[model samples]
Target: MAEVEDLLEGVTVRLSAAEEIRAKGRRRRARGRAVRVGAGGAALLAAAGAWMLLPPGDRGTRQTVATATANPFRTDGVIQMPRADELPGYARWHWTESAGLPAGAGRRSGPLPQVGLAEACPASFAMTDEPGQERYSLLYTGRDHALAQYRVIAYDDTATARSQVAKVREQMTECGLRAVPPTARESEEGSRAWSGTVQDGRTMRVTVRRWNSWVSVAEVLDGTPAD
Candidate 1:
């Protein structure tokens, strides 16, 4: 009887020890899982921040941003710029938005193809106004001239043109360019040359010039509403 009792006590001690071991194993597993989760979360947050702070463009490639106000010319899911008469005196501008130095960053002239950029440059694309803006523009310069011309295309109301110009002028000032207010410098008789800015409520402007059919133009695209 004594031996039996001793044996029973030994069994109880062994069971208790097994239970304690299981509990320790569970605690270790939980701790390891929590560490992994925390490390993963940190990595994800760092990546998101880097992406947001990077300049707006294709990664490592030269690109441009074009901002267009709401109600911009649209057809078949594509945005079309309006003629100057419809909105009046609005032109556009382009700002290069790429990291690394562009390949063909030099004097270029004449109107480029309206659609995609050329592959010859590999980098250095014109940034059009983002369609997200209230007003927007596209710009081009001559291979021979120092003046950068732009076209302002906007669909905003008729009241916001000057404000658009002021904003764009500030941006251009950073690039060592000044807003040349509209002057009759190049007007010829009835065919007037426009250098002045017009606000179409979208708050935009365009650098305008008249020479042949290929007018030199730069545009300032204004944001309509941030969606």
Candidate 2:
């Protein structure tokens, strides 16, 4: 029995070691996401140089553009997410264009100003509604075309936004679809946002999150198409 106990102890140590190795592998995988080209720094330098060579004031023209409130932006279902550590196109956009902004909203909208995040297009879009009343929609190409991926941002308090969310879910149910019930452990990100899932019997369900009055939905539309 003593020998058996010793052997089990050894096994436990090996299992702990294995767990540590697996955790390290996961960290490495997360950091190495996507592929790196050239020597990293060199590729960035080339990209910077190309950007600088563009016609003077070209950036101002490119950024003043705005995608409509309802037009679908991504046929391919991809949005260029803004990185926390970097400046997005909002810097180039004209914050002075507050013509149709939502109520209580300043000239500046929420953190993300682009609702029509392009899939194949690289154009920048602006949040044009009034302050605190700004509304925007973002779509991403899912794994399948039948799967509908929608991310909507509406600037309003929690109750107002929640009611709208409920209404949207109700409509989805009428179409034989389900706003995927979130898992028990699902968590929120801030005072204004939460994430959930919805499904229509497809292999992939849309995962959605609302953060700081902005809503983001991501899904792969492959197995089943949107009705």
Candidate 3:
């Protein structure tokens, strides 16, 4: 009976060793699959990153994303003036024969000269052409033969525009100009504006507005007294 017990123990030990070898083989296969899956995942992430870093083409939809997201009120660091043709009616107005006033005519020190029909401060105007300052102006005539002036002035930033607008307002007040209440229909394009009637015999609707980096002034004669 002792010999039989010893033989059974040896057989049991052999079976256990075979099972251990099979288990090690299964573990190795599972580890190999895990490593392969990890490598595949890493490759996918690398490919995605590479695609994200690709440059956008000139005509690609992404090319306009920056412009679309940009603020319209922002100045492009270039002096921009509204064109005479951009007036209310394309055919109702025509450009004057003259090239318009000098560059610095809008400055406080350089008032616009009283040209034949044009008056100084036809519309309240302020601008600077110092090293970093920029401004532009355009003049037009409506079908009724009334003079219309448009001015665009750029500043270092929105804060500067605001300060400049205030200064112009103070100057206008000191000049004894009368303020006209702006109509609710007036559009300022997300900017600060002051509208008034300059009591110079002929009624004029003058507007001064300030946006992100620009100040714009427009004046139109009402063709009547402001009584």
List TM-score per model, in order.
0.24, 0.29, 0.44
Instruction: Please name the candidate that would achieve the greatest TM-score relative to the true structure.
Output: 3
- Residue 39 lDDT in model 3? 99
lDDT of 1 by residue, 1-227 (tens): 11222366456322335567689899999999999999999999999988878876544333211322233244575545444332333233223322221234333322221111112121223453432223234333221111222332442333343343333444434333334445453232112221222222233333543222222334333432222
2 or 3, which is superior by lDDT? 3
Give the residue spans of candidate 3 off by over 4 A: 1-98, 101-117, 121-131, 143-145, 178-185, 191-199, 222-227
- Give candidate 1 misplaced runs (Cα > 4 Å): 1-16, 56-227
Q: What's the lDDT for candidate 3? A: 0.52
RMSD over all Cα atoms, model 3: 11.8
RMSD of every prediction: 18.6, 24.9, 11.8
Off by over 4 Å in 2: 1-132, 142-150, 179-204, 210-214, 224-227
Higher-lDDT candidate among 1 and 2? 2
lDDT of 3 at 26: 99
Global lDDT scores for all candidate models: 0.36, 0.38, 0.52
Put down candidate 2 lDDT per residue, 169-216, tens digits, no spaces. Answer: 443343334445454433322112222222333333334554434455
lDDT at position 122, candidate 1: 16
